[model samples]
Target: MPDTTLSNCVRDAATQAAGLPRRRSVPVSLIAAVAALGGLLFGYDTGIISAALLFIGDTFALDDTVKQIVTAAIVAGALVGCLAAGP
Candidate 1:
């Protein structure tokens, strides 16, 4: 029979030679910047829409009920998106 210690050493050496590949990691600063930019854009878009709501109501002669519905639609869309992006 082959020597047990010698066989073990050969297996360990083979494993070392076939070592797992190293993984590349994303930088924290880059991730933080991307997240910040996304937040900025979302806030900007919401603000612009809110500001334009007045003009839209005036141009379309929308009543208070219709205006509320339009605002609710935006909130509903955001809720759906939040739900879809689960943790």
Candidate 2:
């Protein structure tokens, strides 16, 4: 016969040791909201730049090289910022 009492005792001990209650110290919804806000801002900035580039090019009479440089500058800045922030 299986030892049900031993199995239940082991399971209970494991659950207590895992400290599941501490996990909710910070609300999941708040964490998700902050993450969502960051993503929304990133998307907004990208879209604004994409749309503005057309008008900026037209206004400045930019050549292909200059347009490429402008786009590359934004990407490079983002790369540098990411690197500085660290993993």
Best candidate, TM-score-wise? 2
List all candidate RMSDs to the true structure: 13.8, 7.9
What's the lDDT for candidate 2? 0.80
Q: Tens digits of per-residue lDDT for model 1 on 1-87?
A: 855798676776777788944333569778888889978977887787778789999999999899889878886887799799897
* Reference-based TM-score of each model: 0.52, 0.54
Q: For model 2, how does the per-residue alpha-carbon lDDT over 13-83 read when each residue is reduced to its tens digit?
A: 77789964423435887889988997898778777787888999999999879888987888788789879
Supply candidate 1's per-residue lDDT for 70: 89
Q: In candidate 1, how many Å is residue 55 off? A: 3.0
Candidate 1 residue pairs in backbone clash: none
